[model samples]
Structure formats: structure tokens, C-alpha cells
Target: MKDCENLATCGFFRKHLEAKTLACQGFIRQYCQGDKQDDCKRKIYKQQHGVPASDDMLPSGQLLAGHEK
Candidate 1:
């Protein structure tokens, strides 16, 4: 699987990667840089809405607490 093409510009990743949380890293490995890239909720939300999801939105589609922007 290829890394997600959107990684460079993904707001969620840019915002959360600073924390370096294991959960965030896991999500990146599982969805952003793995076979599940196509299944990423960020990709799905953008594809379905024609706009990027909120920066706090995780790859799994769950919003991170206290990270809203």
C-alpha cells in the first residue's frame, strides 16, 4: 500500500502529529500509510463532501477532544 497522497496537506495529521501519541501513530500506520488508506475517514469525508474534514477529525472519523480549530 502507498502512503496517502494527502498526507502533506492533511490538517488532521499536521495538527495531531505534534503530540506524537501512540494512538495517532497507530492511526497513521493503519490508515494513512497502510493498505487502509482508501478506507480512511478523512478521505471518505472529503470525497463525499467535496471539502476537507475538520482538523480534529481522526483517520477513523472520530473527533479528538480539545483539538478543535
Candidate 2:
């Protein structure tokens, strides 16, 4: 395989690849064996929208805006 000078310009670099950048797939398939499906789906959402669960916030409202689906 040819090396890419800039992966952004490489045709082999797919959009879904960003989802795997944080080792999220392995994290789900391994530690979260029972809830792998939900874990994987959440990771994919985070990758696409850059939204993380705000556990530190108050229960009534969100600190950062993101669609809750």
C-alpha cells in the first residue's frame, strides 16, 4: 500500500475511520461486552458530532448543546 502524505487527501481514508481513532471499537468489543452495541453507537455519534455526555452538569439542564436522540 502506498503511504499518504496527507491522509485528508487520500481516497483510502474514509469518514468512518475517525470513529476508530480513539480505540472506541476495541473498547466496546472488549470491556463493554454486554453493552457493546450501545457503546459503539454512542462512540460513532461522538465522532460525527463531537458531543460528549456531560456528567458533570446539573440534572436540569445541559452545559453544551447536543441533540438527545
List the global CA lDDT of all models.
0.85, 0.33
- Any runs in candidate 2 off by more than 4 Å, and if so which? 1-39, 53-69
lDDT of 2 by residue, 5-68 (tens): 2224321123223445344334323423433333333334445666632322211122323413
Q: Tens-digit lDDT track for model 1 on 1-69?
A: 788999999987787778778888898888888998998999999999989999888888888887433
In model 2, pairs of residues that clash are: none
Report the Cα lDDT for candidate 1.
Answer: 0.85
- Report model 1's TM-score to 2 decimal places: 0.87
TM-scores of the candidates are: 0.87, 0.23
What local lDDT does model 1 show for residue 67? 47
